[model samples]
Target: MNGLEKKQDQRRRFLRTLYDATGGRRLTFILAPDIGTKLGLTQEEYTSTTDYLVGRGWMKWETLEGKASITPAGVDEAERLIAADAPQPERRNIPAPVIAEISRAFDATYTHAQIDNIFMEASAPGAPPEGSKLRKVAAWLHRINADSEVDALDIFGRLVREFLARPRWGTDLDPHAAEAYDEEDSRFLDALAAHGLSYHDGKIFGAGLLAPSKTLAELIRARDLTAIGKEFERAADKIASKSLGPLWKVVQRHLGIAPTPELDEDLKRVLGGLASIVAGVGAFRTHAGDAHGRGPGAPSIEPRHTRLAVHAAHTVVTFILETWKGSK
Candidate 1:
């Protein structure tokens, strides 16, 4: 090659070598002799090249006692030069099989909303600064899609288990441990612990998992669906019994329920079920002792039985929601 070409090549090689040495670490020191030996150049050539780099505004030098250290700008130039010559490959689209595995694993332990939020956080940059676990999971998913050989479910399951088992790194009461926690972090250290589930951390340290508040919220919301379903059933019952009929009737009239055959059929079914329940209760009262054997008073409802009935209704509503809405 020509002298100009050779000079350019030398500069490129020098920058690439510097970039490789730094990797992800901050602050690298290079002695003149070491650079000379690596580049197979004499001490004078090394000194001249170093001067050339400084002249080009790519590097600056500092002397501390006898050793020389490169400035931050020098590191940046090295990285930039290396990156310009060897650009990183574009991130590949995540494969369908990997997405399926993630979906299955998430669904088994968490609600649809939780999984959805987790992905949303993963897709959005700066959305979950505190959720290292979520970041890990997103990384793993990307790796799995890239070329990871392990089973996605097993890997993801291991990660989830680990997340459940470990005390969150930041929440430890020890002063040294607490120092690691970022301020305004919303992620919890113990989520499933509040719900009575436990796991081990050692088995899943390498598995990518994220434990952002979004994921936790999704899980909690799924649990709340059961409560909401119960409330809905109780409200339905009260309305059917005319206890809250006026309110429901007003809603029905406003919504033009009578004009829709499907609405009419559903309403009929609800009223019929209530009538059957009342009839059954009345039949039981008739079989009990009358004025001669019992005191003159109305039949008393058992609070425990009412509570159990409410629970059963709630469970039924929850089942319907799960089957139809595919949530909770």
Candidate 2:
């Protein structure tokens, strides 16, 4: 290049050497001919550049022996040049399946607005580029993991731990009760299957509660009280007629009650309560669950109400299954 451009380049190298050696905080020897040789500059060129920087207050010599340090302004200039020469971070493309899974987990737990806020925080001091909230958050997650900022599994694990810690049903119960209370639909259904009332191809016989229970779960997820209540009524009917009828035969033989259509008084009362529970769940759904249309003053249905219905269903189903198993 031209002489002037070449001189500017040499000055940059000198400042960079000083910045690297001491970050501009301590003096470095600048007089050695080998120093200029290492920088690909002749002694004359090095001396000329050093004098130019000193005159501009960009560097100062501490002694005649040439111990020198870069000035604050010189350090700033060096940093700017370094940044200008640095490569930009490469944009990474996240796969659709990975993004879909991430979005599903977060959507299940967070409100739309809350999720937006989370994405904003994760990419803070700068907002994510224009896209759907899911896409933006997914991209940020991918970028952070690629950069070694944090592992994606660690983030997911934290979310799971937080969800487990929170009282999803809004109750303050002991861990044992809560564990039984929060029986997932799949787990509860599996328990019923082992007791000879298995679900298959979306249909289940004997108990007949299986299909409706599955429907109830979906409705609950959607926060559909009216549909949930109607399904609960159907499930209760199945529990009373289909589920109990078969189980009662076994109970009669076990209790030494004669094989007859009529149940003895004591056993009748106990079994009747089971039917009553089913009826109660259905009734709760009818009145409070919004199964039927309401007046303007009708009470609002909350998540706790749905949770209560599900928990009651679990109790009935579990008791019946365990009873049947015990009798066998």
lDDT of each: 0.47, 0.57
- Runs of candidate 2 with Cα error greater than 4 angstroms are 1-9, 19-34, 61-69, 75-96, 117-328
* Candidate 1: segments with Cα more than 4 A from true spot: 22-27, 64-66, 87-328
Per-residue lDDT over 113-183 for candidate 2, one digit per residue giving the tens place of the 0 to 100 score: 66656555444223454566566556655655565444443343333344334345634555665565365
State the lDDT of candidate 1 residue by residue for 1-328, as single tens digits. Answer: 9977867766666655655655524466555356557888666666677677668765456554323444566677776775686866543333444444433444444444554465443332223223344444455465555543444433443445432433445465677655533221112223323322222321221111223333444644766567756646755655546433343443344333323456567676764454344444444445432423445474544434333444444443343344434432
Cα lDDT for residue 68, model 1?
41
The Cα RMSD in angstroms, rounded to one decimal, for candidate 2 relative to the true structure is 22.8
TM-score of 2: 0.34
Among all candidates shown, the one with the greatest lDDT: 2
Worst 10 residues of 1 by lDDT: 201-210
